[model samples]
Target chain A: MTYTEQLNAFYKMVSDECVQGVSLDCVIFGFHDTRLKVLLLRWKGTHEWCLPGGFIYKTESVDVAAERVLRERTGLDQLFLQQFHLFGDAVRYNREDTWQRQKMPMPFESRGWPERTLSIGYYAVVDQTKVMPTADFMTDECRWWEVSDLPSLLYDHRHIVEVALQTLRLQLSWQPIGLNLMPEKFTIPELQRLYEAVLGRSLDARNFHKKIMGLHILTRLDERRTGKAHKSPYLYQFDRENYKKALISGNLSFV
Target chain B: MTYTEQLNAFYKMVSDECVQGVSLDCVIFGFHDTRLKVLLLRWKGTHEWCLPGGFIYKTESVDVAAERVLRERTGLDQLFLQQFHLFGDAVRYNREDTWQRQKMPMPFESRGWPERTLSIGYYAVVDQTKVMPTADFMTDECRWWEVSDLPSLLYDHRHIVEVALQTLRLQLSWQPIGLNLMPEKFTIPELQRLYEAVLGRSLDARNFHKKIMGLHILTRLDERRTGKAHKSPYLYQFDRENYKKALISGNLSFV
Candidate 1:
């Protein structure tokens, strides 16, 4: 579509029905190759990247809006999505120079949106291999970037990512929610590596192993046979029933 | 002041300069006599009690607005305040019969307020003895109510209080922030009771004592003396330096 057509389509989509002054930005987290990553989108006609976000419709609840945004971006449904924080800094969208630097029109301002906006930040854990991200009409590209080495994001997105990571790290301490980012079966070393990536530091392997075993949320599985490896560690799968019980009772502690 | 004069004053206070479609409801928590309580206000011309709340001004950040509201109601400043949740149900303010039943004017609608509003829930911990809650123009009275036995609240204030308590319970598992609700010198049993009040369940005394001792975030003080009591338990004060460090590093675990 032409630039005008895309802009007009975007305007038409949002102008009539969305709740004014409110938006939902999602930090979809995925674990792959021993690194934690977040999904970002590059706006059309600009190199500026931002979290996949959209305004809430007047007829829908905020939670439903978040789910809709996630489904539209990842083509996945019923994932563990959590509302973590709300960013309401008055200057969150005041960087007009950013638009000028990127050589893109200020769609929100030009189209007469609310002067001040409050965005609800949500974080989701999904299996990276299961997602096939497709750009929407207003986005030129959609891709995953390592959370540790993210680009210069638009607006307060960098801060949003930091808060999301902090929330994820806190949640990791008490709940076994990170299993959504892992495969159906995984080795102890792989699980430890994912925890290390999310916590942004290396943990003592022996202590981590002892803690995980004490929690008793993971079931031991048959050893994986990587032919080239000297010896394969035992694989494990998260015991779904026990995990849910632990989450509800606040018993799972891995930190 | 007369009812009409108070109502007019409240209308003038909120009509001209507040942000549209956004409000802040504060769940100010206090602990006294081994019970957790929340500050609530009876609205003018209505027996319905609600969390002491106000609107955010266009010129101030939401955080500042929360502090302002708390200070206005309690005459306390620099307390431990946290933004826990945003209540944004489409029907949050759709209960007109609630107003009509109380014979109170629908000031918000009569003054041309937005049809829908999103409220940010903030929880503040303060020493109950230090607070001197004064009624504002819109409030007929302001008082603290035990969380265990609260009266019918306005809007979704009940849900807001529940979320605040849940957040407090979650924070108790990781941080020593509940100290604000405790006296300067407290026994281990007193501390345990505070935790139980926040968690809404009785905890094992020996286990809780051992866990708290292992944390080493409390400085043992001299034993308290009571003429009619049995053996006195040792008193303790939170070691401020270590408490701050634990909060920053996320190491303080009490559960």
Candidate 2:
């Protein structure tokens, strides 16, 4: 009938004929209060925790499947999710604890799910404060764990997490999506702390300040860190228009 | 029969139990004589060039699928293969003009027989000199095309090639896989040209030289480019140990 209806029909047709063979694993990275975190779920059969994950229909693109998983798991709409790595070790599905062997209703699914399931790991740096975490579909619970305290995980998931962190570390050098991880307005120390957490190393306070101030990505806000500090650091908010322009041309370098 | 034979017997018992739906498409990259090149396959149906691809059996891992694809197509036994992107768009299969829809037995498998198929794209940065370019199984012919002048391709292969280029461009900063694309010993100008080709822009020769030399990944050889009229640039080879160390642990700033 209309353009929307035609578009819907196209989507329906695609899913029917495409023979989809894909799924999403979200390396949901979040920074809450001060510590950097990743969203993980205690898997169904075991005590091991893993980043939220699910299978993509035989008809969806890996990117769209990833986004769907992120939104479905976190209850965050349109969170900035990035597909970072694909875990394709042949024995990745050998474990008796994997969700794949759980008799999914989709008959042609993981039935003979390859001995190694190829999982496309997607990273989403979400605003922990803004988004409500909901674990409805297949997770026992979805909560942010300090990156440092990540427990034993299943399969090559540990490696996947490591890769996602590596990608995040690289992204931090050029793209300052850290603002999304923090509040609308954050202090200098908060910004520095987030960077240190992501980088997993200490930065020279003065140098970090100089770098941030030089980029001018942040505008000074009329507030301070408010708690116990020798000097209350000035609050800063991101300059969205400038950031978007820098991002679009792919010039979001902070280093 | 022994337990080993029992395990083998069991494996055969369930070999058909797996559900296979995934595939790997390699956007093999190379730098030949200073021009950025990509390894492409010319299918029999049309002259359209496409990445060498293969399906992951219900029993194999993604990496195995890629390696098998390489072995099946180029006769490359081993090379530096990496999975960079996964193209799972539902409509990626049904594109008109150049897809091999007739030879394939099924949309997914039906290999050897002429057919239509949807494939995932993995990228490999290989020593092109090592690839035998031997035809195997379903492929007609394989050729290395200059990345800048890639021919009309099938499906989402163009996007896959672009993604591989992006991966290489980003990886060039941390890892000196640039060496993999070059001859054993290359002059400074040769190396510079390689970077310029992949980056698709002219870098200041002096500054580029300074930065590359400073990375300490190159070992100057005891020879020079003889044909040049100007000062013969000394030959250099990448110091793999240092490059590997840097790649594994260091933070990269190059955008």
lDDT of 1 by residue, B1-255 (tens): 877666666666665677766789999999888899999998776788888888877667788899999999999898899999888777775467667644575455676566677889999988888899988776779998999899988888888998899888878877877568887888889888888888888999999888887877799977774564598788898888887777787777666
Docking quality class, candidate 1: acceptable
What is the C-alpha local distance difference test score of candidate 2? 0.69
* DockQ of candidate 1, scored on C-alphas against the true complex (2 decimals): 0.47
What are the TM-scores, per candidate, against the unseen true structure? Answer: 0.88, 0.80
DockQ of each: 0.47, 0.39
The lDDT for every candidate, in the order shown, is: 0.83, 0.69
List the candidate 2 regions with Cα displacement exceeding 4 Å. Answer: A1-21, A43-48, A97-115, A137-140, A223-233, A249-255, B1-19, B99-119, B224-234, B249-255
Residue-wise lDDT of candidate 2 within A1-255, one digit each (tens)?
A: 643354355445434543334446788888876688988877544466777877665555666777777877778776678877777665664465444543222332324332344677788897788777776433456677888888867666788888999889888876777656878888878888888888888889898888777766789978777778588878888898876766666555644
Tens digit of lDDT per residue, candidate 2, span B144-255?
A: 9998888878777888888888887877755666756776787788878877887788888888888888878899989888876888888888898887776776554343
